[model samples]
Target: MAIAWYIMYRKKRFDRSHDTEKVCPRADNHPIRINGSDSSTVLSDSNQSRDSPRTSEWSNMPQWLEGLRRKRVASACGIPKYSYKELQKATWNFTTNIGEGAFGPVYKAQITTGQTVAVKVLATDSKQGALEFLTEVLLLGRLHHRNLVNLMGYCAERGLHMLVYVYMSNGSLASHLYNEKHEPLTWNLRVQIALDVARGLEYLHYGAVPPVVHRDIKSSNILLDHFMKARVADFGISRQEKSALHSSSDIKGTFGYVDPEYISTSIFTKKSDVYSFGVLLFELMSGNNAQKNLMEYVEFVALGVEDNEGWEEIADPRLEGKFDVQQLNFMGGLAYNCVNPVSRKRPSMREIVLALSEIRKPRNSETYRVITEETTFELDLQGTFDSSLTER
Candidate 1:
C-alpha cells in the first residue's frame, strides 16, 4: 500500500509541476521519514511539508500573498501562518454567512485562539478592489478611537482579499430602525447614538492629520456594539483632504442620505458628511426611513412654510406626542438645513454637533411643550404645498 501510494503521489507531482525526480520519498507516503521526522507528524495534507527545506519555488507565490504574510507575521508574532485553506476550515467552508454588503459577503470566523471575528471577503469581480480594501486598511489601521470600528487584520492571498474586523454584537443602526422585531429607539437613545456618530465624524474630520471626508455616511454604516454605542464602519468610500483637489473618481453613497451639493458638483467635503448627518438626524427624529416616500411630505412642508402654513402632519407617527417639541423642531430644522440645495448653506459638522448638544440642555417645560404641540400645526400646514414643485 505504501509503494502504491508513492507511485500515485509521484504521478500527481509530475502532473502538478512536472518535477517527479525532485520529489522526496517522504512527500509521497504517510509515516515516511524525512530528516528523522515522520511525514504525518511533521505536516498535514494541506500545509507545506515541515521537513522540506525552503525552496526557490516558494518565492514564486503571488506578491500580494507574500506581502500579506510578512505583514501578518510582523503584526502578530508567534501566531501560526493562517493559510487560505486554514481560513476556509475556520469559517466552515464560509457556510455561516452573516451578511453581504457592497464589499462582499461577511462570515463569522472562529480562529484557533477561540476569538470570534467577522471576515469580510472581497469579490474578485467587484468594481471596487484592492483600492477600496487598502483604503479601509489604511484608515482603520491608524485610527484606534472607540467611536471607530477596529480592524483586526486583512488577508491578501492568491487573489482572495479579505478583511478581519472586530465583530459588533448588535449589527448596524439601519437594522435596528428597519427591523420589525427591534424596538423603536427611544428619543434619548436616538440622541445618544447621534452624539456618538457626531463624535466619530468629528474625530475623522478634526482629529486626523489631514481631514477625512466620509463620503458615505448612513445608518447602515453605523455599527452598534453590545452597549448599543455607535461606531462608524465602512471606510471604503472615505478619503483624506489635503488641498481641496477632488480625490474621488466616482460619486458613491446611498440615495436620500448623500449631500445634494456634493452629488451635483462631484466635490467631497466635511460639509458633505454633515449633510448626510442631517439626513440621519431626520431619520432619528421622525422614526422614518430616509429612502421612504417622504418627498411629497418634505415638499409639502417646504411649500407650507413658504406660504406661512404649518407642517405637523408629516412628523413621524411613531413619536405620537412623546417627543420634546422644541428638540424635534430643532432636529427637523437641522435636517432641512443639511439638505439645503446650496452646499454653502449647509451647517458645518461642528455646528450640527453644537445644535445636537443643545438639545441635551434643560429647557422651560411649558415652552418646550408649547413648541412640541405647535409642531402638529406646522406639519398640517406643510401638507398643503404643491407636490410637483418641491425639491426632494
Candidate 2:
C-alpha cells in the first residue's frame, strides 16, 4: 500500500509539470493597438489556452455568443468589428454595390441603427491585399478632419474583410466633373472644392501628429457630401510620411495623376501628392479626365507661354466665359508650379491654403492683407501670374 501511494504521487507531479511545459504557439496572434503601448481590449482572434485547441474553444461557444464576444471586444477599442451576417443583412445580401475601387467593390447600406454608410469589401484577387486593408483601418481609425472621410466600423470574418465609412450623398467629384447625368460644378463651387482638397492634404501633411502622405490623390477619391462639400477618401495606399520615406515598396497611384519624379526615382514623398494635386487642379479647370491625355492638352497650351498668357485657352468650355479670368490665370500659375518637374519648387500645402484663401477673398473687399509668414510676398490678384507667387 505504501509503494502504491508513492507511485500515485509521482504520476500527479509529472502530469502537472507536463501541463506547465506546454505553450500555445499562437499567443502572439492577438490584435494589438496601433501605438503598441497597451495589450488591452482588441479585436483579433481570441487566444486559446494550452489545454484546449482554438477550434474546440470556438466550437463549444454558441454562434451568436461568439459574435457578441467579438463585437464587445472590438467596441471597447472605439472601432467595432462586425460579423459577415450583420453586414450582409444591412447591404441587402451584398447586392447594393454603389461603386468599385482598386481594393474592391463598395456597397451602400443602412445599418440597424438606420445610419447609412458605405461598405468597402476586399476582393479576392485585388491588387490591394490584407496589409493595405489593415493600414487603412488603423490609420483612418485615429485620423479625423472635416475634409477627411470618417471611418465608422470594420468587418473581418469568414475569410472576408471590409471597411465602413460615412455615406456621402452627392457621390464622387469625378461624377460631377465628367458624368453628364449630373450637373457640372459651378466656378465658385470648383474653387471651394479645390480649397477643400488643399485643406485636407494640408491636415495630412502638417496637422497630423507624424504627418501622412496620401499616395493617391485624384478626382474619384474626392467625395462630396449633401452640402456638396468635398472630402478626401480612399486611404488604402496611404502611409505615414516617415514609414513611406523609409519603405522600398512599389509605387502606387493612378497613372496620369502619379508624380513624374516618383515614377523615375521610385521614391514617393509628400511632394508626390502635391504633384498629383496639381494634376487634379488642372482637371478641374479643363473639365478633362487626367487619364485621357489631360496633361498633354495642358502642355500644348502652356508650351511657350510665360506667366498665364495662354491659360485662358485651357478653361473648361462648359464655363462659357462666366468665370473671372484673373482667377483662372492665378489658378493656372499655381497649378503649373505644383506640377514643376523639380518637386522642391512645389509650394507646401499650407502655402497653397493661404494662396487659395487669397484667391477666394473678394477683390473689392480687402486690398490690404495681413502677411503671417515672416518671408511673405504678394501676388497681384488683378495682374497676371508672377513667378514669385508660389515662391517662399
Candidate 3:
C-alpha cells in the first residue's frame, strides 16, 4: 500500500486527514520467481544502510526503548493508521461480522478509498496479546508476496486494536473444501493452490533474510482471492528467526496440523512448518477437515498400502475419479514425507515447490498452454526452474 502518516493521538481524538492513501494494486497473475530478494528482513538499527528507506529522525529513535515507542513508531511508519470511528463507519458499527478467528471476529468493510477490506478486531480476552499483534504488523509490513495477504491499514484507539486487510472474495480454502454451498474444487485447482502455499512457505523459510516460522498453518488460514488464487493469511503467532535454525519452547499451532516433534520437545523450526504443510496437503487432497476424522482415515488407508500406492482410497470421493492417478500417487508420497516423524526427513519447502511443479505439469503441450493461459502464469513445466520460479 502507498505510505500514510502516523496517527498522532491528542486528547483521545484522532487526526485522520492523512488516511486517504490507498493500498497498492493487487498482484498480477504471472509466473512468479522465487528468489532471496523476493522478501525483506525486518529493519533494525544495526541493519540500516546509507540507502535504506528510513529517515534520519526514524533512524535516531531511542534504541534503548525497542520494546516501547521506538519499535512501534518505526515499524508502523509506512502503514496507515485508521481511527476507531472510521473503521466503525466502514464496518457499519461492526455488524458485518463475516467470521471469527482465535483473536476475534472478522468484519467485511469497504474503506473510504473504495477498497474492500477485512477487519479483524482484537478481542479483549484474546490469547494473542499485544506483542503478537505488534509481531503481525511488523511482519506484514516488511514481508510482501503474492501468496501473502496484504495488510491495508490498522486501528489502535479506544482500548481496541484491529487489522485491515485486502478482502478475499472467495473466503478461505477451508470453506471451499468442506462447505456444501460451494462447488467442489477441481483437481487442477487444488494442485495450483498447493503450489501457491508451498511457494509462500518457501519465501518465508529461505527468501526472507531472517527466516519466519508461520507457527500456525491451517486450511482456514489459507484464503482465496477473487480469481480463486490462494494467499497465506493470519500471522499473529508468527516469529522471525535470527538464523535458519531458530527454535521456540512455546508450542503454538492448530491441533491437527501441529508437528508431533514440536509438541513432544517444544522445539519449533522451519521443519515444524513443513509438518503442518504436509497436513494441509492431505486436507487439500482429501477435502476433509484436519481436526476431524481426516488424519484417522489417512492413517488407516496408509497402513493398508506401501508408500503412496493406496492413497487414492483417501482421495475426496467427490472428485469421482477425475484426478490424475500418477500425480495423486506422487503427491501422496511427497505429503507423507513432509509429515515424517523425524523433522529432518521432511523435504524443505524449496524441494516441495519443485516437486509440486512437476506434479502440476500437464500431460500434453496443448493442455499445458491452455492451463497456463487460464492462470496467466508462464510456468516452465520442463523442470528448468527458470526465472519464472523467482519472478514476483
Candidate 4:
C-alpha cells in the first residue's frame, strides 16, 4: 500500500508539550500517573458547571453501601461524586435510555438540581468495565476543551459504576450520516464537524496536561450539540501519553477505522488515532460506512489527490454539486494523507486543525494558496510518489 509518512519516535521541543506528560504518537494509553501533574487545577473555563444535587439517603442497594453512606469515596481528580440512589432517580429508574457503549447503557435524565445529564450505567458482566469507568472519570475530569464532551459527575456504589455527562441534544454524528430520518449535513457543516473533531483530537494530543489518545474516534463516537458543534466523547478506551499497555494487553478500536500498521504490530500510538480520523474524513466526504473498509473501496478515487474528477467520485453525491471543489480537494487530499499505511505519514491533529481552519477562509485569498504547500503529497511507504493521483 502507498504510505506517505513513517512513524518516527522522537521528542518534540514545544513549550506546552513537556517531558512531564511524556506522550508521543498514540501516547494516551496508560492509567493516570500519580505525579504532581495529575493535580494541576482544572481549567478555570470548565468551572461553569452548575451546582451538583444535594446528597440524599442511599436506596436500591444490597445493604452494603448503607454502611458506607457518610464515607463516600472521593474522586482523585476532585470531580463531583453522585450517590447511586441519586443517579437512579435522576435517570428516572434508568427509563430514558439514550444509547450504549463498550461497558454499558446510557440514559437521559434530569438530576435533582434540574440539570440535564446523560448517565452511562456500567454493565455488571463486562470485564473491562472498571478500567473504562476509571479511565473516563479520571481523564475527562482533568481534561476540558470546547471540542471535548464535559463530564458532569460520576456514581460508584453497590456493584454499579455510572458516569454523568452533559446532554447533547442533537446526538451522534453517525445518526445524521447513516440514518435517513435525520436531515443531511451540508458541506460547510460537514467541514465544521471535521474541524471540530480535529480540534478535540488536537487538544487530546497536545493541549491536555498528559496528552491523551482517544482509541475509538468514529462518527458514532462524535456527538453534535444543538448548535451542530461537535464534541469528542467516549474516553473509556482512551490512554494517557505514558501508557503503552494497549500494545500487549488489548487491540481496541472500530474494525474498519483501526490503523493498518497498528493491527500488524499491535502497537497503537497517537498516529493510530490519526488513521481513524482519516476514516472519519472519508465518512464526512462520502457519507459511507468505514466499518466495511470503504476507504479501500475508493482508494483509487483518493489516489487522484489532485484530480478534481477523481475526487468527485469520492465525495458524497448528496451535496448535489453544492460543495466547493477546492475544499473537497483539500479535505480529500488531507484524508488521503491521514490514512497513509505508515503512521508517521499521517498529519498530526494539530496540523489537521490548521488545515481545516484554512479551508474555512476565502478560496481566492493568499491563505488558500498557502494550504497548497501543506497539502503537497508525500511519497508512499515504498518511497515512490504514485503518479496515479492524477489519473482519472
- What is the lDDT of every predicted structure here? 0.63, 0.74, 0.70, 0.69
Candidate with best lDDT: 2
TM-score of every model? 0.70, 0.78, 0.75, 0.76
Q: List runs of model 3 lying over 4 Å from the truth.
A: 1-75, 243-249, 363-392
What's the TM for model 4?
0.76
**Tens-place lDDT digits, model 3, residues 59-107:** 2223312422322332253667787899999999999999998989999
True lDDT of residue 309, candidate 1: 28
What is the C-alpha lDDT profile of model 1 across 233-345, one tens digit per residue?
Answer: 99886776532336455778888787767766778777788878877877776667878855445666655553322334446665566666556655565567666667665
lDDT of 2 by residue, 250-278 (tens): 77899899988888888888899999999
* Model 4 agreement with the true structure over 219-316: per-residue lDDT tens digits: 98899898999998988878764464346546787888988888888888889899899899989999999887697766866565442345657778
Off by over 4 Å in 2: 1-72, 75-77, 247-249, 304-308, 364-375, 378-392
Query: Least lDDT summed over 10 consecutive residues: which range in candidate 4?
Result: 52-61
lDDT of 4: 0.69
Return the candidate ranking by TM-score, descending: 2, 4, 3, 1
Point out the higher-scoring one by TM-score: 3 or 4.
Answer: 4
